[model samples]
Target: MTTSPAPAAPAGPDLTDEQWTTLVRARATDPQAVAKAYAARTRPAPLLSQKDTLFLVAADHPARGALRSGPDPMAMADRRSLLARMVTALDNPEVDGVLGTPDVIEELLLLGALEGKVVIGSMNRGGLDGATWTMDDRFTGYDAASIATNGLEGGKMLLRIDDRDAATAGTIEACADAVTELATHGLMAMVEPLPYHREDDGSLTLLKDTPSLARAVTIASGLGTTSAYTWLKMPSCDDPETVFGATTLPCVVLGGVPSPDPAQDLDSWGRALVQATVRGLVVGRALLYPPDGDVASAVEAAAVVLRAAHAGEDAA
Candidate 1:
């Protein structure tokens, strides 16, 4: 069952080599440029579009030490290449916004690539990937106050629950507090919750079963003083309807580690989008460092899936 391919991406912005150098120089010599750019940016009127679906390009993985994409171990390690790919993806009109850490977000702001786009700040990244204390995901990135002051629409946090790991408790408590703070500011508190277990070697393994995913949703939904402004950033598990049914809050499906077969990954997202609660997509390496190296094509394809899902909702 081959799905139709998405339309080829149009030519993106022609950023010159000199411009890239200038951006780097500004970052070093004029650190205030980022703040000035943010002040000058044309903020989006509302976070969501008329369809109430948001397609956000995520660039927060590198901060967590998870930089591998496809077969390359350090695919996302190059800041220039990563930012270039991100720029290309954002140039597409179908791509609505971005979710990134402070550095990445500031870079985009300086480049003027985030103007009129929904910006989501990544809140937690202390749990370095593949570390022994990976479950101790701390809020070392953006906090609610910073996000509000920076004029971002929301903030995202990672919540990985491991019964055997005592760090999970700290992560949960931190996320709950973050939710409350973001809500107090009337900002979105996006939480990505996943259940896991520690292996004998001290490595963590994600439990993708519906039951486990459902439990994570249940626990995450109840966090904070209110679920009023809370949103769930969930993975596309086997039974998305059953798993996502565990929450009534709005949800967006994340593009997990890039898959070898991009089509299969798109299919998984398409299946999950059938659920009304699955608002849209928040993808990263899959679109930024695609197997074919066509960042624009990858982003457009995901946007197509999101549009189709919304169309179905309208028909219903």
Candidate 2:
């Protein structure tokens, strides 16, 4: 497939080196700066608008050791560069919020880039990419109490169910516990449940078929004591309407690994957003590190998709 021409790199953050040095110094001197920043930060008025569509930039992949974006394996390995791209993506007015692990979220908080944004904490990341125990995702990150105490909007967890893998049961139980806990705190519990099959080599492969996705959705929606505050972060499937028909809970489509063709990837997301239950998008590498390497343009393109979806809804 012919790739689109790479756009010129947009101007990065000004004085980023100096600012990073200062941030490092502060982290070294006072570990309390993260809490202070969170306390002092201004939050968005409402988590979702009247249309109920949210376009969130996700930065939680690195926590799972999945940092490859498009070609470069270590593309997101650079802390400073990743933050610079994230800040650029968040600079867009149409962008709603961010979903990240504690470290990335706290760094953005310190950089003051998360002000007036809906912040969602990543809960499970123990299933390191390519690890033998990859199916055993654990809740090693932010919990309900910490997310609420930090003034975050919600917590997200990954639940990969592989019937062949006994470890999957533990992940499900842990995620259910997290969901109940977050709901008790009146915070959103965004669960990403994907069905998988364990190969003979013990490696896991996600089953992207419609039936698999629907089954996973059914299982995830029923997790926790209550489904009131539960939301789903799902992939843009070929038949989203059928897959999403399994649950009434609100969902945000995730931008999985970057597609070689960026336009085709955006088109898929746009189509999924046409489903009423699909509230918005939670994209990461695709928007932050596009094949064109233009974070701003990639973000703008995603915003355009959401806007068009909203316009269609209003016309109906």
TM-score of predicted model 2?
0.94
RMSD of each: 5.7, 3.7
Task: For residues 199-290, write the lDDT of model 1, one tens digit per residue.
Answer: 88777788999999999999999999999999999999889889988888899999998788899999999999879788899999888877
lDDT of each residue in 1-316, candidate 2, tens digit only: 9986643333343326777998788889989998899899898888896677888999999999997776677777878888988899989988988999999998888888998999999999999998887777988889999998989999999999999977788999999999999999999999999999888977667898999999999999999999999999899989988998888999999999878888998899988888878899999988888776778888999999888977977777
Q: Where in model 1 is the C-alpha error above 4 Å?
A: 1-15
lDDT of 1 at 234: 92
Candidate 2, residue 124: Cα displacement in angstroms equals 0.8
Candidate 2: what lDDT? 0.88
